[model samples]
Target: MTLELSEPADVDLEAVRRVARAGEPVRLAPAALAAIGRRRAEFVAFVEAHAGDHLYGITTKHDVAARTVLDDAARAEFGRLLPPTPPSPSTLGPALPERVTRAAVLARLTDILHGTAAIRAETAARLTTLLDGPLPAVPEGGNGDPGDVVALGRLLRPAFQGTLEVGEGMALINGSPMASGVLADAVLSGRDRIARLEQVLALAAVAACLPDMHVDAQLGVLWGDPHQERVLARYRELLAGGTWPRRAYQAPVSFRSAPRVLGGVLRTLAHAQDAATTTLRAASNNPVFVGPDLRPPLGAVLSNGGYHNPLVSPTLGALAHAWADLAQLVTAQLNRLTDPPDGIAAHETEPRTSLFPMTASGWAEQARAAAAPGLVGLGRSGQTDTSTPDVLAWRRATDAGAALDALLGLLAVTATHLVTRRGDTPPPALAGLRDAVLECYPLDTPPLDVAEALDAVLAHLAAR
Candidate 1:
């Protein structure tokens, strides 16, 4: 996919996700490529017009001494010169090399489309080409900031070669796309963890059910909330097969609220998606381009925080915590599903005997004995064997477990949602639940990644 540059506003989460998922040799749409080309041309034209001007980086002064201008052609040597300044102390480890830098280049183009920054369209196109072609190897792990700074410097270094102007280095280093991509990738990765968890939940349900269980009513309410009848219809489905309890019990009792549980996860992912897309199109640079149409002062102005990244930082942090939460949830659901005696209320009877356990009386004794907390170091022995069990703690543990399951369910929902759309399925509501196990597993093709998982969610809903 050849890219034609356009404003970042035109791009979506899916676009960013596509690039990240593709990882290498990502093609920009022809139109976007063209736009980048045009923007690059604009910057070149700016350099040409201001060739004689003592305008900071273009001619003379750069870095901290950017205010000190130089008008001589010898000043062009400044562009080729490596930074003489000392590196700042940082705890972010090292910068990402070319592989990660390629992502930055693509994101930088997005910033260019937002009409901010100083990359010439041809230069930008070159950068894009580099991204689309062979990229240099970047070392993994170290300080992300310096590594990014060095990576971009090295990347642009080849193109700018001996002709780099002053501010050019700064231009490459200061922006938000790289960080935003990290956040975006984090979100995608987190979502993937979630999808896998949902798959786990389904498996757990199957395993825990002594007899097959029906959770249709629970799922139906989630699929469509305002429609009470639809919710009840799902309830009826659960009651079908004559395999259910006489009274509707909150499943796994806690799982009865699966719809609500899953719904929250869907909504959070949607919010994260919106945040990511916004950053993608945002004009993120210090000295921003206001375009020829804008008034003089702000046109060439260098503003602080114009290219700032409050969104990416918090989003990344939130996304990391979300991953932990998701891991906990899936692990819990798996525990319950595998432990039917703990989760299930009843079991078939058997007898216990000294030599041969066979009668109902013996079976009852064994069941009672087995039901007792045989857990060592449980500290339950402090109480009499007849002591009342801590039902509240038991319930709390169950809820905590389900909460984890829901976390994973959210990912599953998002994954299914995205894949379905990519496949040309209708968009599903990001706030509802599916009607049954069958509805949840609507994907014809198994998901291969986070995006695929989201697509599956969408496919399920679209099929509905």
Candidate 2:
């Protein structure tokens, strides 16, 4: 299926996913074609009429070399001055996964569709076609050529070598499309993981004998937090089919605060998705053009800093922290249920269920350490080079998500242990999870064998 790209607003995470992950094609709608053409005409006229070497990236050098200017001959050579992209490092090191590359391509196309750069319709069309075939390998440890110019050039240059015109080369490279594209994938993946993890939390709550009132609707009303209300309400649905045995003491801070932590995941990821959406639609073209339309000949060549997107770092960083917080909470729940030293847990369930499941893995601590936020580089006078921290942000978020896999498996099996020892059937919401976990490690599977059983449990849960 073809996903149509029209207005800048048309580009979103879902569209990018379809084209990037599901292998769908994209079409440039006529309206976008008209907007792109109109903007290109103005930029071309400005470039052709001006002889001075002040044409932003087209005529001037990049980064600290911005002080230097190229002559008319260099500008006229048609993309000759553009730096050559480095060779693919796929054999030597890791390459960007197929989905991220496709997403970056779509992000770049959306940036151009904003009509801020003077790229030809043909350039946009070629980018559209590139998505249908084997995309170029963007290595993992990318040679951080300024603004990813080399990487973008490598992707776009194959479109046409001889006539790759002025402004087009830099336009393809400028902006935070890499950050936006990566964050888009993070948001989508994070949402799915958070959703499924919530179900696991429901199972943990039942296994731990949490009072249903802990997530009752009234708690949301007292706190005046609608997010908490919604989160608690979900717990109710998942816990309804089963019964919660009253406990002398309350559930752990993790369960008491599950609504808050889970709500935090929802809030932060929405903010991250919003940040990505804004970036996907925005034009980060330096020396951006204003057409002679409204405001009586708004035609002007404006120098601006539209390239670096600062929001990507903080929002994605916050998301990583959310995952970290969840990891800690779930770890506490798993240990509380499995560890015999916790007198409260031992009172409610069989002592034979005792085993410190948290001891089996230290993923929670690792996630906590990675939760420290990255800085958005605002270039200062003495710095060697300004840099984007999105790559680090991407790394942290990915690791944060990965740390959950084993931790969740341990929690899943431990919850099943509680359900088995207590002679209780898992509630409807937890039944499938309990069944999957026990199927991997049946009732006879010893607690000491949890290490060996984790792979099978994780595999089972993931397949669902």
Candidate 3:
């Protein structure tokens, strides 16, 4: 389906997911084009009226040379000279997938349509064309300073050649469009993973025969957290009418506190969604247009530092930490399901002695390490002044994705182990996941490769 972008408010997490993950097409709404045209006209008139005034990168040199002023003739010449110079690192290793590149372009288009970047309506149209076609590949491994900007500029320059007007190219290449796109994709993927995690947790609860006590309506009233209440409702829904025997008066903390822990994850997802949606809709360019339609005849262009997105970093870190906590819970539950007191000791067999436990432990450790918050300590050199939000967002997304993968693997393994012990009769709610798990590794066979099993489970979840 084609997504129509009418305004900044239209760029939601689901639209981003459809474009980035599903390769859906997008179009700009007529209202959005009209808004861009109005803003561009106002900005152009303002710039012409103040022709001699020095504007960063518009009528003067960039960075340390901003003090120097250029006349109209020099400004025209400067535009030609400002094309991003190719750096020592020519290409980003294993170029970003086409879906990611498309999402980035769409995000930039949203920024332009918001009418803050002062890009011509035609420029926005041209960008839509570029996004509709193949996008230029962005490079990796910049010095994490303005190097990321330089690299993005070089990558995007090819697409705009012979089509861009003065100051427009800089607007396209500047700021955090790449970061915005990457983070949008990450947030979408994280949301899906969280949903999958919920399903797996429900499956685990049934496989281990966790009591329905925690999800009782009375208990939910005591918990009081909306997120906890939602989780409680979902758990009750998944386990209703199941006749599995409760193995103990209380499951381990991981199982007993499952609703609360998963509720925390839901809260984190909500925060990340808010931050990502804000980033997607923001005009994150330097020298953004600002003026009062009521107070001023022409809007003024003001220098801004909106490109440094402080929210994306911390929000993604929170998501990673929440997923890590989920991993810990999965590990504890898996251990409980395999070792003593609650587990079916009769099912403890050979060749797979440490396989499931070792796999869960290894995955849990990796997830924990990946969950370490990134982008902390703004006092660090280059971060406050020249750090690239794109790089930071990309890394955080990568870490979060990895954590989800490991956690999914652990859950799949544990679910399979449980089904095997219970005479292959899984609860109705988990029947689909049980069948998917068994399809990967049959009964009485040595455990299938953990990574292979994980991929299968992920594919199944995606299909659902």
Per lDDT, the best of the predicted structures is 2
Give lDDT tens digits, candidate 1, residues 69-172.
Answer: 66555565665553443343334334343434555666776666665665544555555667656555433332233123444454555565654444455555
What tens digits encode model 3's per-residue C-alpha lDDT throughout 188-234? 76766766676788877776777767578777789788988888888
- State candidate 1's TM-score: 0.58
Query: Which residue pairs in candidate 3 have backbone atoms (N, alpha carbon, C) closer than 3 angstroms, thus clashing?
Result: 92-139, 92-140
Which of candidates 1 and 3 reaches a greater lDDT? 3
The count of residue-pair clashes in candidate 1 stands at 64
Better of 1 and 3 by TM-score: 3
Each candidate structure's TM-score, on Cα atoms with residue i matched to residue i, is 0.58, 0.88, 0.89
Ten residues in a row with the worst lDDT in model 1? 348-357
User: What global local distance difference test value does model 1 have?
Assistant: 0.44
Model 3 Cα displacement at 336 (Å)? 1.8
What is candidate 2's CA lDDT for residue 32? 86
Candidate 3, 113: how far from true, in Å?
Answer: 1.5
